[model samples]
Target: MAFLWDCYDAWQRALAAEFFGREHAGQAVVFHIDDDVAQTIREKHQLPESLAQAVKPHIDLGQRSHAFGTILARAQALESEAQPPRSLPLLAVSVLAASRMSRDAEIQAINYFTPLKRLLYGEGADDNDRKRDALDQSFGQVVELWQQLDRWLRSNKGAFGVSTITPDKFSNRARIGYPLSQALARLADRQKLTQFFSDAEITPGKTYSSAYLLRMLDAWTNHGRKRFSRRFEAALAEREPAFASLIVREAHGWDGKVLDSGGSGHLLRLRLAFNHKRARLFWVAPIATGISGGTLTSGGTEIGFESDLSPYYEGIERLPLTPASIAMPLRVHGRAAAGDPLVAKYSPQEIILFREDPHLGCWVSQDSVEAHEEHLLLVSPEQQAEVRQVLQVATSGFVAVPPPLFAAVLPNGWRLYRNVCFEDPAALSRVSRRHTETAARLRPNPIGRPKLVGGLPVLKELGSHHYLQGGAPDLLLPAAGDGSRRVSVSLGGRTPRTDFRATGYPIPLPQDMLGPGRHEISADDAVLSLTIHERVVDDGLPLGTGTFGSMAEEIDNPAITPLVVLARRNATETAFVNCDGTVWDAITPNVPQWLHRRRVLENAPLYYEIRLEPHDRGWLIERTARHVMAIPGSPTWPKEDAILSAEARTDWAKLILDVTAPPKHVLWPVYVKIARKILNDHSR
Candidate 1:
């Protein structure tokens, strides 16, 4: 994460240069002023030239008398609009001066320091090479292991090393498999690790080292190795603290089981925790395109877009495409008894897969259900027949696209009537609060509003710390006395708090200023300050531009816009941004409607979006675009059209993107800069 403190420091310097006519002198200076005394001096009818000269050292001496008077007026305006009883501006000024001095000193220190990049990345040539090779190989192995795990986990359901049968009825009820058999199976499952170790030339008695074993374990388990590794290490802590630390550091992922006391203790613990049976299985089906990007597959699979289109996704009524279950096994159809109207809704088509959750029955398969009408209706059994008939009638070479698939899973009857199950309690509560807050924010006078979707109202505790949108500051500020003269704000808007005090760096002021006081005009008066200073800076570079001016200037350069990108590698969100306002978003937004309806084919946008504040600079567009492109035929572009014509494509693409791309925000400093120019000086 880039720090915001750096940007604040830069802005402060820019303010000094533009308003005080201070050139970039070889050395930075610290000054102080007394705000109360300064105010009194400004209010005086007249001051003797000697008195004025005495005060001049603490003031922007270069400022014209008229300009000086304007400063005092602006100060008063700030005082009136401030949030509370204003402090003396002198103190603020003195603080700023000292802060700048400290920053300059730090910069001087940096000048004397040696660059550490080479030291960090370089060691003895031979050792460095070995380390690099080892790291690269380790990463490759990790990836291969992840692929293996992903494949193994795709199975609908099955026990790895256990049988369901038991001699005792109570034991059978516990679902516990014979421990010895399970143990043997687990050992067999270690073949992958064994192969890796062998390939790496590691052996238990001769060539093996603990690091090698740990590395092998990490590769085999992915990040799931943490828990068991910790347990094992904890058991060995007294004998080997160094080994324990090493294991903890190497550990990652969430899989693994340690057989303590040569296996007996492990069995006992498992039995105790799970009533003699412990089972875990994970199943995920990426849409047809896999988990590469945010796109809906013909089947029920969904991948995320690098940048999620959730705002639009959540607002849309249904998916843009329709799919149905064309073929499925276990098509056990039953008709409703004639007496009950509700039960007569449809000829129930029952299907079952490995039941992962007790309450979750088979999800509705979009490939099986056909759509003919604008709206999909769950109607009486008679209605089902009519709908099917209508669908058949319309099947005669119809050109219209099918409605997006929507699905739901009905819990098994027994689980539904007997007990409720939730996947993640924390997640459930979080999602509930966010949904409710969003719903409330959408309406006028939202007090006592009902939820937009069916779910429990989010309890206050759940959402108290949750900021659904727009909570964190878009830009960070470093201490002023960090030797940084100007804070480059990559973000677009002005910071929420323009005046901030950073550790080791005080608020900035002139070399002669001093004492507690309010600094920088409030927003209402900021415009006036800008009007007087009217300084301009290059949008693409750090260079200053023409002096104060009221004429508007058109910035047609590509550098002014902010660009955003997104990508998902291994089920994680990665985002990026560019100065030019071209934004890319790739997100595998879950289609909740499909999940809620228990449908196999998800009928909703794979991404969603919600507009928050104006713009944030840290947004990355490159990553998003790249991630989206990684999806097979994403945007479903033809392979032939996927080609980029020339190296000059940047110029062409920028033109096209400016007209066609989605708009997003820029980081704070940039926003603040642009805002200051437009609102304050009326120049673009």
Candidate 2:
């Protein structure tokens, strides 16, 4: 033993120097426990056998580091003693050493057993029948060994002797042993594993109390928690990370709040667990009372920005009437089979209240208590004073309201009791897919009149942030009867865009510039001397004649303007070409006459003249005569000139032609057709 101690002491010194950057000559650098232990020894009379055996091999009681070194050395010696020359005497010695070095012995036992478990539960071994039997036997041996240790400890410790009693223990002598007995039972339950340092025989002096017992109990609790954690990991092996995380989370009882994404409930509560060898499970709570799985119900008060119940909003005190929120308790009353009345309600103690901000609109009592009452207590208070205080608080400050209004405002109020279940992963996957599909169907597409002769539909595209497709190629436009006139189309409701293209025709180049802001179209006709620039005047007032704001349909203020208009000016000799390639000379008086002819060709008949008086409706033109002809199909342009001397006054046929150029701008619909034909025909 002496040799072993020296070896361990030397190894510890070396490790400390190498690991802690400390030299042997440093001032008081080594660890020491005597300052505390010596005082404890003086107060307790004789040193505990545990302390003596644990420290006997060390020369320096002043250094905790040296004492621990002795303990490690003795452990090594015990392991060696277990060899071929092992004897019952050596076993007794080992037992004594272990009782003194309780903490170290526990650690060594775990290390020794782990490898054995791995070998016996060999990986990929095909014999399932044998594996099952081996596991049962191994588990049994562990339990038996654990029991033996418990018994040995109980016999040695003299039971955590101390002088003071704690609040947790106020009972007399017969009940003095209750806590110890209860701890022992818990340790032996197999379902639970605990580390305790107490014995039935140990007792403090006659005046000793429960405070000391409480301190020991706290130590044992923490020790058990750590011990169980390691054992659990060893038993489960590689399958432990996720399950361990889950256990720690559950042990701490953390919770999360979920808001509406469109389902039956607006709020959700979740609790999850995973044991790799077992199945993963979760608990869910919807917000609907009597909803089999809801965590809240309609009887509760409403919660929101205006509610005075929650302190969530920054300027909540500024609102006129603050909103209130609640989670009302559910009560069920019915007749039983035995003709007895059945009345029950979920107890407040059984529920968990989770609200970060409690003052305004954040949370409310689901019970039939006052609105201002705090519903934080989950279980009923056993102390009569506490119960009375709760009742008094509920009655004076908070008051309950009608049930229907409660339901209407808080539709997702329900309690998620223990039995609530989670969604199946497979089913949830399908639901998500369906949600995406529905949103797609509601998406808008832009379709228009065929631009080019054989144009195909362009796949409508939208931007990442766009809510709807802007240009659908499938939408049809009002026809230009006989395919001779121009047509116009509008996309005002479902989709919106100021930029557009004719599936195949070219007018507005994909990269061509449009003016700043949100105006759609403008156009001009030189011969007609008409130029219209579509303008929108949108002022922030509620009376703007544009997309969003309006006090009335017809806004007459400075902010309102006509949506579409045609601008024209009488210009000098601007010419237009006939279908037959004719040119004509025109001056001021001829302006009306020339317009008359052009309008006929374009299928736009003028109902009135520019003169202030009502204008004549019917007046077609004779291009050959260079004069007005009031008929639909006048004698085919008199192809040959009349006798020069006889009909010279009206015999003016100089191929009466007008030049035509592609319009700089026209209505999108009208221009798109001309554009399509132009792009398609080689001789345009």
Best by lDDT: 2
Candidate 1 similarity to native, TM-score: 0.17
lDDT of 1 by residue, 167-201 (tens): 11212211111111111112222223332332223
lDDT by residue (1-684, candidate 2, tens digit) is 455344333333332232123122211111111222223432444323332232234323234223223333344445321121111111222222222222222334333223222333334656544433443333332233223323332333322111111111212222212111111111111112111211111121222123322322333333222233332333234322222222222222212212121212222222111111232111212222111221122235321211111112222122122111123333333222233332223222223332212222233222111111133222222332332233232223322233343333322432221111111223322333434322111111111122211112110111011011121112211111111223233322222333332111223212122222122222111001111111322322111112433456475653432222111123323222222223233322222243233231232221212211112111122222122222211122222212122232121222121212222232222323332333344245
Which runs of model 2 end up more than 4 angstroms from their true locations?
1-124, 135-398, 411-684
- Displacement of residue 44 (Cα, Å) in model 1 is 80
| lDDT of model 1, residue 515 | 15
Error of 1 at 575 (Å): 19
